[model samples]
Target: MRNRMFAVVALACILVGCGGCSTQGVARQFADELGEVALSAPPTGATYYLQVDNARVIEDAAGDVDMPYCYDLPAWSEDGAETSVVFRTARKLRDGAYLRFDAALLRGMISWEEVGYDELPDAVREVM
Candidate 1:
């Protein structure tokens, strides 16, 4: 009887511990919003730009790592002229070597506008 009781307790502990392994509520919401914006059809003739800051993984970085990285995804509409910017998830580089698709900077995005490359943060003048 003691052995059976121990087994049941162990199972309960394991289940409780597993809860912490799941994604946080905020992270989940960020992902859902990003996916909705990214997967949605682009406005007619509009271009989609992903403006991402460095993931900030390093304590002290130098050179290009400090600059803002932006990637221009294909247009959702061929006739659209609108431009949209979406911040990338922290630590996810624009053209980094890794293949991560689960991170985004913000839970929401702003409207389309003509934002100059130089006007971007970190003096980012280059776009990928």
Candidate 2:
């Protein structure tokens, strides 16, 4: 009975592991959003409003670590018809990366998420 249970659990683990990396298909989602916000049907290249600064490094048990980094990504539409915003950051450089904000990604400031992540108290959300 125990052998049978172990085999079943092992098979489940193997199947789960086959899903591979976590951040796949990200480009496709971005591409779809670009189509909506572009005049050229897919945004012929982009001018990113990204600014990299002094990111922190944190290490934990099991030797797993996180490089603390955060970014504020906003966009101005062609012809200036509409403006959209997003706030992104990493609590960890790996799988924990995420897009988190509230109330439509406000004017690059006044976000509780930005003030608290990545061991940074005063990032000042760079908008390029």
Q: Quote each prediction's TM-score.
A: 0.24, 0.21
Candidate with top lDDT is 1
Q: What local lDDT score does residue 31 receive in model 2, on the 0 to 100 scale?
A: 32
* lDDT by residue for model 2 (20-123), tens: 64324543354333322223223233222122232432233333234233333333322222233333334533333222222321123223332223332122
> Candidate 2 at 105: error in angstroms?
16
Off by over 4 Å in 2: 21-122, 125-128
Superposed by TM-score, candidate 2 places the C-alpha of residue 99 at a distance from the truth, in angstroms, of: 14
Error of 1 at 11 (Å): 20
Candidate 1's TM-score reads 0.24
- The true-structure Cα RMSD of candidate 1 reads 13.2
Give the Å shift of residue 78 in candidate 2: 27
Each candidate's clash count:
8, 0
TM-score, candidate 2, is 0.21
Cα lDDT of model 1 by residue, 65-123, tens digit: 55333332322222232333343323435432312122223523433433444433331
